[model samples]
Target: MLSALQLHSRGWRVSVFDSGSAGRESSWAGGGILSPILPWNYPEAVWQLSRRSLPLYDALAPELAEATGVDPELTASGAMLLDPDQIQAGAAWCAAAGLAAPEIDAILQTRGPSLPGLLLPWIGQIRNPRLGQALRLRLRQLGIALHENTPVTGWLRDGGRVAGVDTAAGEHRGDCVVLAAGAWSGALGALPVAPVRGQMLLLRAAPGRLKRIVLDGGRYLIPRRDGRILVGSTVESAGFDKRVTGAAREELLAFAVGLLGTEAAGQVETQWSGLRPGSADGIPYIGEHPALPGLWVNTGHYRNGLVMAPASAELLADLMEGKPTQLDAAAYRLGAGRL
Candidate 1:
């Protein structure tokens, strides 16, 4: 969606083909954290992408809201990292990133009594579904063709370049092609992408109870403005099976209860799952295919797709236009072997 929007803004005609409805997959299902849970843990590639994308989100949320008359409900709600190891690493990470490092007691007192943690005041989040809606609305306003429920069965190649795509309807050709097919990119052939199933639990808390986004252990709790807190998630290599298993639900509930106590966990509203497009390495494949000319790929962004989307699209647009980019574009090329 970002790619199409950017391309359209540049006076290029764009058409988006989704296997299902747009924003129905990982983009909608995610907790919408603008930054990674542990910013220090990921590789430089992830950091670079997130750094660029983060600022874009700050500008975009309100811009789209005003333009499309749909508020994405972005909030600088901040975050509480409730792990001793992460807390220990916080100062160094902050120093490296040139961010503030608050005292652990201050963080615990302000945001929690659960455990020792780190306070990140600059972090923000968005209501992802609303963001998607705003994007779709804006795209329509821009005259971009959105083909929902349109599945691209295969690519239409002319000589060595990608001519277009073969859909159920017919062949829809274009000047360039971007394969941001998400988890289903595996069906496009040897792309080293697979589906990683993640199950999430939504629980309701009183409006002022849970103050901010809390990352405890490996699980995260994202509090919404409507007193609904989203507790997630379990990263499992369950292939394309998006089924919400009882065991996973129970496990998530247990984790939520453990972190925020039983009172918060009892108000279970709903549970769901999404298949993230896991790449060969944790880093996403974001440049043109080495072997396939005129064929570009912007998928393979496993768990961090939402946080990485803006910069990924920006980098992709730079490459597509043969313009100078802020980040090293060659680092994300589709070469063999892992990062």
Candidate 2:
């Protein structure tokens, strides 16, 4: 949808085809941390895309809310990293990236005292489901053709140069075709994308119980505006299985309770899972395909889809238009080393 919106805004006729309902897939299920969970852990490419995309939301959130009457709840609530070991590296990364240095703190009144953690006050988050809702509405408002519940069966090939997609309803021909199918991109072609299931649990807590996003180890606690705390997530290699297992529920609930104390033990509201497009490395492919002319790709975003969406869309648009890109487009090309 971001890609479609980007193209549409640039005076191009755009149509979005989804196998299921728009915004009900990975975009809705994500935790919506605007920045990478652990920026120090990801590659330079991931950070490059994230750094460029993060500021775009400051304007986008309000634009969506004003246009669609659905607030995405973009918040600068900041983030607390409990990993004391990464403080030095995190500080260095912040310095290099021109971001404010993290403040060293030992105690969060809500979660109690612990080893001193890094408090980054600039980190932002969005209510992801609401963002998805706003995007869908905005797409409609812009008069972009949105074909929901329509699965593209295959490519409408024109000899070597591609033309458009083949759908069950009929043939929807276009001058260019972009594969932005997320985890399902692997099934369509020789792409290196696959489904990696991640399960998340939501706990109904007091609105003020948890103030900031907390990251401990690989898991996180994202407190929403409506007193709902999102506890996520387990990274399992289980292919395409979005089942919310009891084990994952227990594990995520335990993690929530462990951080927020015993009062959070029975606050479980709901549990769900999403399939992220897992690539070998975290960097997504955001350029034209070398083998198929006029066939572009914007999949393989793995875990950072929401974080990198805006810049990814812009970068893909730049490549498609043969314009100078903001970041080095070579890093995200199809034949680039890591998919």
Candidate 3:
């Protein structure tokens, strides 16, 4: 939808086709951390797209709320890293990236392990489901065709060049086609993408219980505006199975309770899972296909799709329009050693 929105704004007729209900998959299930959870751990390619995309939400969130009447609550709640070991590297990365150095011991209230933490006060998050809702509404208001539950089975070809998609309804001929199918992109061929299941739990806590996002031991706690704290997630190589497991639930509950104390034990509202488009490395493919002309791709985003959406859309749009891209486009091309 972000890609469609970008293209439509550039005077192009755009249509979005989804195999299932739009935005109900990974986009809806993701904890909307606007920045990479552990920024220093990721590659330069991920940061290139993320740093550019993060700031775009400041203008986008309000635009969507004003236009669609749904506030995709973009909050600058900041992020705290409880792992004391990574503090030095994190601080170094921040300095190199021209960001403010993380303030040590920024979080005052803690009931769990007494570990030192570094806080990046500029970190922001969005209510991803609300963002998805706003994007869908905004797309429809702009007259972009949204074919929800319409699966594109194959490509509509014209001689050697790809033309459009083959849907169950019929062939929807177009000038070009973009495979932005997320984790399912590998099924369409030409991308080394697979489904990696991640399960998350939501807990309804008091509004001021947790002040900001907290990361520890590969898991995170994201506090929402309406007193609902999101506890996530378990990274498992469980293929396409999105069924929430009892073990995952118990594990997440334990983690939440450990951090927020025993009071959080009964705050469990619901548990859900999402299939991220796991690439070999975390960098996503965001350019035209070398084999199929006029067939572009914007998939393989893996865990960072929500964070990288805007800049990924912008990069894809710039490439499609033959404009000079903001970042080095060569790094994200189809045959850029992603496999």
Mind giving the per-residue lDDT tens digits that candidate 3 earns over 1-339? 999999999999999999888899999999998888788899899988999998788889999999999999999898887767887788788888888755555545354446677777778899999999999999999999999989999998899989999997788999989999999998895689999899999999878778899888789999999889999998889888899999999999999998888888888999999999988888898888888888999998888899999999999999999999999998888883664
Q: How do these models rank on TM-score, best leading?
A: 3, 2, 1
Return the TM-score for candidate 1, rounded to 2 decimals: 0.96
Error of 2 at 82 (Å): 0.4
Note the Cα lDDT for every prediction shown. 0.84, 0.87, 0.89
TM-score-wise, the better of 1 and 3 is 3
Candidate 3 lands at a TM-score of: 0.97
**Which of the two candidates, 1 or 2, achieves a greater lDDT against the reference?**
2
Candidate 3 — worst ten consecutive residues by lDDT sum? 104-113
Q: What TM-scores do the predictions have?
A: 0.96, 0.97, 0.97
**Candidate 1 per-residue lDDT over residues 1-339, each given as its tens digit:** 999998887778999998788888888888888887787887788878988888888888889999999998898888888777778787688878988768777665633466567888777788898989999999888889999899999888899988798998789998888889889886773588899988999997888677788888889889888879898899999888888989988988898887778786578999999989998766888877776777788988887888889899989988899999989986687876642
RMSD of 2: 1.5
